[model samples]
Target: MHDDPRLEELVKQVRASRKYSAISEALVRRIGAAELCKRATLQDAVKATKKTLHQIAGLYLANAHPPYDAWLRQIIQAPDDTARRAVLRSIMNHHTSTRERLPILDAFYARVLADLGPVRSVLDLACGLNPLSLPWMPLAAGATYHAVDIYEDLAGFLRAALAALGVAGKAEARDVITDCPTDAADVALLLKALPCLEQLDKAAGAAILDTINARCIVVSFPTRTVGGRQVGMRENYAARFAAMIADRPWRVERIEFVGELAFRLTR
Candidate 1:
């Protein structure tokens, strides 16, 4: 796709920004190619690409390039699981999405994922620091966890954090919208991800739901905006999610928390 000189140049320009440099090349190319098609010139495409990137990801991060190496070292040197969980929570607080979920972190996973008994494997797509909540989840012995995100640095940090926690899984930097993972798993977690994904492509939500290979999928949406405004988002997202899965044969169960709304779809 980058074969076109214009597209290649667009990708370079978009990634040139320190804020977007760590995003996967696949995602950069995907959005850049689309922008190149719509915009009249390479500069226009580059500007549009950065705007889209900020909407989909940058806005959620408190810092574009977090101190992942330092966080990793903190996790590695923690005295026990309790200490590690504290470090993980601190790291998660840097992202708006995860920070909001912190209030209910202790019960969020247990209640939402309980129906899928004995979770042995999981696929977390567009995962930010949510994977750090592994301590709160109930997993079977030797369970494998697979998580993917567009940020290369964050993905690397998650990979090392998982290893440090003695969990069995791999975290990778992937543009799931373009390259969805096909690995079969007991459950797939799309926590507060669909809305952000739709910012890039309107059909991304349905596309991801259709492609993920899992027996159960737990999808969540924020009930309030980042600024703590309640604007009927709950009702809006509930209806939107209903429409998104209206054609499927899966059984859906709705779960609501203080600031988050979730649905469990079982096939």
Candidate 2:
């Protein structure tokens, strides 16, 4: 998180914007002006405050690096707790607005569920602290969900979130680039993970796609920035993905851009 340039730019934008004015002022008053100067960004300060609040509330979930932590800290320090809670609750109900590129995740779920009828199980690849594909959990009501990811801590975090949401799913420790299970998945989801491959080569990403022997695969790439920040354009992903499945029997069903993200549904 510290090395991400995108994060750095986002922090700068947040500091200069009116959105975080009240929270920033509250933090400076509570934490002191001198302490705020020591940190690189206000987001960092918010993170520290949220840690304290979470510790106080004893609300520990398996989900590590929860984005709500920052929001919670801002809300708690506000003058009115009721209004703060209401605002934060509404934010949580929506997809993370902080993300640079946001695809309509719910629509993708609907399409996937309708496409893959009566699937036995699902394997969600690169599942981070937040499980974006959670809605599909109901489709395979009794099926085992094997969520795999490089972030080892994410497994516990996802397990807790699933439990809290009353979703029955299992988490497995896996690095998609290095190791992908041979277990057949009825459907596979590769969503917004291509940008996280800082060290891995393009071939590694392609390998994961090749290994997922599912009936249908739903993959998406961010097309533009939702926050008006600079990000690497995913210009060649479609061609690369198409090449991987060229020799396969699957047929491409949909390829369209939604907001700043491009989605492809192949069956």
Q: Considering summed lDDT, which 10 consecutive residues are worst modelled in model 2?
A: 55-64
TM-score of each: 0.97, 0.56
Candidate 1 weakest lDDT stretch, 10 residues = 1-10
Candidate 1's C-alpha runs over 4 A off are 1-3
Tens digits of per-residue lDDT, candidate 2, 11-40, equal: 444334333322222222333232244567
Write model 1 residue lDDT over 156-227, tens digit each, in one string.
Answer: 899898999889899999988889999899999999999999988889999999999999999999999989
Give the Å error, residue 37, model 1: 1.7
RMSD of 1: 1.1
Clashes of each: 0, 3
Misplaced by over 4 Å in model 2 are 1-103, 130-133, 136-138, 225-235, 260-267
